[model samples]
Target: MEPRQLRAIMLYEHNLGTSARQTAEKINTAFGQCTIAHSTVSYWFKSFDKGDTSCEDKPRSGRPVVFDEDLLRSHLERHPDATTRDLEKELGYDHSTIIRHLHAMGYHKIMSRWTPHALTDSERAARVTICESLLLQPHRQDFLRSIVTVDESWVHYNNKTRQAYWVLRGERAPTEPKGYWELLDEKQTINATICGEQLEKLAPEIATKRPKRLSVSLLQDNARPHTAKSVRHILEKLNWTVVPHPPYSPDIAPSDYLQIIRTHLGKELVIYDDHTYYCNVTSANGWKKYWRCTRGGGTRCCAARLHLSPDYKVMKIINEHRHPPPRFIVRNGVYTKIG
Candidate 1:
């Protein structure tokens, strides 16, 4: 039975002076046609009567206040320009105490950071115009075909601590879990791009064999280096087309494809076999499957067939095969590898 029901039975037993089981049976049998044991009901009666109240719910104790109502009200009215230390000095409280007061008063900290495409209205329009003119030109395809996307991003070497968790009132929150941030000395932020050189490395089959006749259309944001005269002149000399994106349009860029590629790449073992598969997906290219039938014989795999639509089930199978086997690998390695 629930504690509340037991408490209720106890209350009835205390007020009526009945045996615990009899009271429980009476309470249960009264409306529901069910009887609780008389002995079990008596235990509740003893517990309820021993305490000040028979109610199951307990009272809550709120956080202690650092300042009185008048001081808090005054501080709220004049805290527009006050720092935590300033508030501390004015209210005769410590910095943490002032911070707690501010939190209680519904203040939160804000994070401010900057990235590419943080441009003004005129700057953005100028970029969009460049892209539009290139698109409108007849030679656009010559440049677009050669264009490869490039960008860099971060990866967690280790799983970081989760930010949100459950906690009771007045209880301190737990810290976030740690991950890759502490590992490798190389760099936390990896600068990658599908630019010329990186593109060649990513797809050597095409990069090494394809001639300079392949003029790629390069799309980038208005970062300082990207907008500089030298950057444009280099692209022109290489017979490449530079298509600068309007501010904040990554959602439509080819690099957006790369983002999806990287996310899947990070979880690569879970979805793919090697870096080639990763590049293929991001390159807007198709796949080349090499399947074989074992003793549990199935149809021989299709070698050179064209299809209008892909089988999602086949993709799911590929993804399942990507991740490294788990517990089995651990068990097999433990005996032989561990000393």
Candidate 2:
């Protein structure tokens, strides 16, 4: 396994109350003798004790392994739950190679929120009882035969439309439903007005789903539409409490806050030609820095990058992006981070 990946395992073992010596012995036995020294395992455990569980190399690195980033992405598309070690079976890569490329491609093991809503205690108990009953039943084969399993996937396609409608098309296909443009307009641009409306729409569903609860806690990102005056007013009128969010948080998952990895310059920004670039690679040489589009890792995966000299002057531009700029919301007038 790569040093970082192995350190991750050591952290995991520490969480499970395993001794450093035991973890070292286990890993060495599985991989080979002297694969990982007991001293190295203990050092990592000490680092974990200090609550520094970062797996990235501290700068200088090594190795000449071929860990296909595309194949790993494809594997993840098919098996989102696959662990780092699990990639070895299909990718034909060693632990170090896989870990190196995964980190290089900005991949990290994250907990997947599988269900839209969580099951209640009673619902969980009922499911447990149902599973127990099925296991105890003698006609287990019959039970299996009666159930159907399927997977959900997204399919996209495009078809050309005629420049103009023909006479053969009767009534112009009912004009494609009334207020179609209005519906599209409402969703096309989600500003303060639309965001407020969406919250109002969600109010009823929350009330219906969690009727017994006296209050609701709504957590949202620091997006402008989400925190605008109209949206805040709507939330206040609905009596929903809004959870405070960090100004520059890239993700708003509740679990993410549990392990805060504060960056040296939290999402450093660069403004050029009315366009924004985020600090993708930190400049340690005191001469040049690398910046990337705000939406580089999202569905758009914008490839745009900006190179800057030590004086913060633009050195070069790479590619183009077609996504909205990131929203920066500081609590006070202070610029905690900027270009």
Best by TM-score: 1
The C-alpha stretches of model 2 lying farther than 4 A from their native spots are 1-187, 252-339
Best by lDDT: 2
lDDT of 2 by residue, 1-339 (tens): 777778888888999999999999999888899999999888888888898888776653453355567787888767655666777776777877777776676654421211222446775565566446546857556443323211111111121111211111112211111110111222365578877877788778777876666566565556688779988888889887664444433222333221112224464455442235666676566543787766646575876688877666567876343332333322222123232
Question: Over the full model, what C-alpha lDDT does candidate 1 score relative to the true structure?
Answer: 0.44
Alpha-carbon TM-score of each model against the true structure = 0.31, 0.24
Clashing pairs in 2: 2-96
CA deviation > 4 Å runs, candidate 1? 1-9, 21-34, 52-127, 138-339
Each prediction's whole-model lDDT (CA): 0.44, 0.55
